[model samples]
Every structure is written in structure tokens, then in C-alpha cells.
Target: MPILTCSIPLLLDDLTELCIAYLRDSLHASNC
Candidate 1:
């Protein structure tokens, strides 16, 4: 994985941000 090439913390943060954004979009879609 690219995470193996870069810093662990940075990879984790990036993954976390992606998850949060995905969940937010799902919630909005369900509301509509």
C-alpha cells in the first residue's frame, strides 16, 4: 500500500477525512 511508503499518521488522517466526507454525503442523500 502507499501507506507503507509514506508516514503512517498522514495516511490515517487522509483515510479518516475520506470516510467522514463519504458518510456526510450518504446522510444528505438519504435526507433527500
Candidate 2:
């Protein structure tokens, strides 16, 4: 249970980074 708890946040952080990067790329494409 403890291992799962620690890994969840790491996964979430990676996902958040991916989402932000994707959003930035999409916005840049639209502007050009």
C-alpha cells in the first residue's frame, strides 16, 4: 500500500507535465 501511494503522485506529476506540454504545443500551432 505504501509503495502504491508513493507511485501515484509520481505518475500524476508526469501526467500533469504531459498535459501542460500538449496544451502549449496546441496553442502555439493555433497562433501560427
Candidate 3:
């Protein structure tokens, strides 16, 4: 249970980072 709790946040953090990166790429594409 404790391991599951710890892994959840790490998974979320990775997902958040991927989302931010995708947003940035889209914004840059729009600017160009």
C-alpha cells in the first residue's frame, strides 16, 4: 500500500511534465 501511494505521485508528476512539454510544443508551433 505504501509503495502504491509513492508510485502514484511519481506517475502523476511524469504525466504533468509530459503535458507541459506538449503544450509548449504546440505554443511554439502556433507562434511559427
Clashing pairs in 2: none
Put down candidate 2 lDDT per residue, 1-32, tens digits, no spaces: 33344445566876666666776887899999
Give the per-residue lDDT of model 3 (tens digit) for 1-32: 33345445566776666666776887899999
TM-score of each: 0.62, 0.63, 0.64
Pairs that collide in candidate 3 are none
Candidate 3 minimal-lDDT segment of 10 residues: 1-10
- State each model's CA lDDT, in order: 0.64, 0.65, 0.65
Q: Which ten residues in a row have the lowest lDDT in candidate 1?
A: 1-10
Between candidates 1 and 3, which one is better according to TM-score?
A: 3
Give the clash count for model 1: 0
Model 1 scores a C-alpha lDDT of 0.64
Residue pairs clashing, model 1: none
State the lDDT of candidate 1 residue by residue for 1-32, as single tens digits: 43343434555776767666776887899999
